[model samples]
Target: MSPLVLGPLVRCVEATSAAVWVETAAAARVEVRAGDATGEAATFAVHGHHYALVVVDGLPIGAATAYEVLVDGVPVWPEPGSPFPPPVLTTIDETEPLRLAFGSCRTSVPHDAAGNGSHGVDALRAYAMRMADLVPAEADPDGGAPRWPDLLLFLGDQVYADETTAEMRSFITARRDIDEPPWDELRDYEEYAELYRLAWSDPAIRWLLSTLPTAMIFDDHDIRDDWNTSLTWRRAMEATSWWHDRIVAGLASYWVHQHLGNLTATERALDPLWRRVLDHEGPEELDLSEAIDAFADRADQDPTSYRWSFVRDFGNQARLVVVDSRAARVLEPGRRSIIDDEEMAWLDEQVRGGFDHLLLGTSLPFLLASGLHHLEAFNEALAAGAWGDRAARFGERLRQGVDLEHWAAFQAGFAEVSRMVVETASGRRGPAPATVTFLSGDVHHSYVSEAQHSRARRRAGAPPLQSRIVQAVCSPIRNPLPRPVRFATAFLSYGVAGVLGRGVALLARAPRPILRWSYVRGPWYDNNLATLEVHDRDLRMWWARGVVDGDDHARPRLEQVADFSLDAPERSQRRRKRRAANRSGEAPSAFARRRSISST
Candidate 1:
């Protein structure tokens, strides 16, 4: 029997259940064994590729158990002669604090000096190595429970279908003519399957997947660059004959490999395709290739027919709302929205505050730099014919060119969501959360910012904005922006871009935004992985990067870049008193960033 092609990846874990996804070399019955509890699922084929998701149930809440995968009564994972530590599944518990790891935009290539020099060292791989050689007692000096992430939220670009690695290019060159339309990039479902195989086959990353429960949402490069940015862009893509096949294959393979793994057992039960496949009663493996392919095609044509977004509540600890910002966009000429009416309505309903924290996960940051936000909103006005037909055309081109299709560019949607956030924070929607945080990626840089409601509203005896609204972004888990490009981005987003953008806005008679914010932690450009620890009275965040020590690319050390402790209302006052008492000391830059929040 050939080896397992890809997974044993733990996905969508609940208190008592966990979902494990795996891809096989051929059709087989896969079994996940944890102690005496076992869940068996037969592999389903999609265009000749086989995959399965086994729902492992009856797991004790917050218990750690060694798990193994068996294919056809033969052990396939945790290889007999494997050198790394054994993989284990740690079930989640609602009573404990939630710690989540999040990042986006990783490109899989070799981990040698050449690859590290070009794309930067892989943060995820380094983290995996750290997890493997961990000394549990040392990790927690007090001898209490150690800090292990409950889940990993992959914001986007898990696989770059549009950008091919050297290995992928070699495979493409061998099979097909490279001088053709797609060139080195992927062309069909077979190519995409191979791309995913290359991405996940790395030993360290594979081990990380086996142990960690991951939740993923796609961004542009998952399909193509600037996908569905505007009506014209969509039209241009639809004009290409190859685009149809590319999109169908991308969504189909994604459904089988990525999106299907994100759903819970309950959500999977409601899935129409899953329902049809489950209706099959047989001892043999079920082949749903045609059905999956048809569903992908239909979803591509009518995005509203299938909803990609979902909500997960952690027993009043927190609520996570992961939205599909790309496909669910309303990209008509006259009216454009980041999410369609149906999606927006669903989002509005979920944004109500009931949990301790409300996490809005979009691949794009909702709260960008104030300067950049103004520029994008200004561009939207010009594109909406505020100036005239000629300027509108120019605005449309500029919008797609600079990649300004974020929440700011869709003013109506941005305003609507902003209002919803205000309502939630002000206790109008429901009992207010301690913090409303927007966790996002896709700018290739990471930062944390806090929104400041105007003091004028408070002066007028209006209810003070009690809840903290924060934006925490982590991006480019491996890919780093070029130095020159980084300089340009910083200058344009913070300096000349703001003044000129606002001047254009005034010329076009655009209205001002409802809120303003400033950076609290960073505008750091390292390829990083970030972790968020949600406490009862504070949210602590940290970013770590891979440092390849002395001639060893295989074992890169994880180093912290920056960290912040954002306090809740009562804790903020206590922290302020402590800071004031120690005001004479010269604090670090990260701590200085925190001190500035008081002025806001």
Candidate 2:
């Protein structure tokens, strides 16, 4: 086997510099050579795994350059006779339009016929193949052309620690007792390392990561489902004999595998742990296994001590703020919030308006369908003792049993962030952008919803909204919901759930939400990936899926599922019609004909 284990992933790319990460067979000096620019770093050890993130600087702005990776002076990348084109590093240039692909909840499975028959096609893999022009011209009417994106944002759930696949289970069973607690689930850094390798090691995906700049954040399944959902949930998990080690290992691996590369050169410089790695000078490789474990433990215990949220800018064109909605949560009773006080304060500083567009990437949707939003809010009230102590106990059970934990479930956090977004849209914070959009995934479906402040707020003198405030959700890039469950989810999220939620809130005396939103497209349940492109002041987004031809599951073709343009005149007309229909009490089914693209 080659010494290069998993990456040479291009990360945190900027006009002047870029970070390239790699995992090696053993500790060694890793070097990235691009044209005349070269960057090298010594491998650091974490639980026997060797890794390095070499920051290459002095690259020309807006340029793409082919790069090669070498370990201990031996070229290891661009594997002998590789079919795909050589990997290239592309830097950001503000004048150019910014495009990015995003989605969440992918399961690692074989990319052949059996896997496609079970979990549907792997949209990310299909996209990677399409980008490389590997799909036959006959498969795509557009000639299988490539439109290279500026970045690839993995919203969350890069790996499902709790939901192990057959391959992952085999790895687990070979090393430990399968009947033990947390059975079939990951337990330590080694397991997580394996899980990541399985997820990213596919030839097409590996090549995609090697060339495109990527950023990621974690959601529940990265550790376990409903992670940090509530104080009671946290307590129950903490009481487990194995939970401590599981959490420590999960988080430690996340820092090294996902979070470290999300930071830019300047941001990494400010990180004390990264500073320790960068400033180390010795013949021996620096080992951080113990230190990383301690840090992850402390971070889990007190989220305020560390921040997982990060910001990236595309010159003055746009700002992408990826929030740590899971780990940074405050689960304390009465003070429960999606994000703690410190994180909220930090978000307040980051959510301001200035660029042509503002993008908020959260693992969970900030705005669900109006009905689902109210339902979650109602559940939150019941769990907080809105009725009685007994009811609160029952509510806690219901909240966990069903996943009633989203932005709406934490009213305080929701309201505060809503206010911040409102301020930004109304130009109280900065020059209002053309759109203030929340890009999220976790719902296992895709949709677009537009929001407006409540009439009460407008009556109380909130400025007329200048920016289009919208929520675009694209989920399950590979994992599609079961057929039966999709019907129920659509009914609840789009149908009577709104009225049911409002009535329950009235009974609980829960305060009404300050914003109203309606779905503009989707509830489509395809396993797909979505991309957004910013052209001057307008933004266009579309979802696409992989379609297998005949028996050729290994070579699925990319097919468009849905497309929407935020500032399109037709969309504006549809929004007006939707509002009129809502006021007239028309059923959501009546608006189905208005969707821009038909579901596949």
The models' CA-based lDDT, in order, is 0.84, 0.88
lDDT of 2 by residue, 87-117 (tens): 8888887788888889999999999888998
TM-score against native, each model: 0.93, 0.93
The residue-by-residue lDDT of candidate 1 on 1-600, one tens digit each, is 555889889988888888899999998889999876789988887888888889888988887778899988888888787767677777889899898889999999899999999999999998888777764222321112375688899999999988888899998999999899888778899999998888888988998899888999999999999888888888998998689888988998888878988898889999998887678788767888788878888988888889999888877878999999999888885668899999999999999877888899999999887778878888888888888999889998998888988888888788789889988888998888888999999999999988866454555565666678999999889999999978866775564677786687677766665666778877899999988888875787888889998889999988888887777865676567657756867453565467667547
The Cα RMSD of model 2 versus the native structure comes to 5.4
Q: What is the lDDT of candidate 2?
A: 0.88
Q: Which candidate tops lDDT?
A: 2
> Which runs in model 2 stand beyond 4 Å of their true positions?
134-146, 568-600
State the weakest 10-residue window (summed lDDT) of model 2: 136-145
Could you report the Cα RMSD, in angstroms, for every candidate shown?
A: 4.4, 5.4
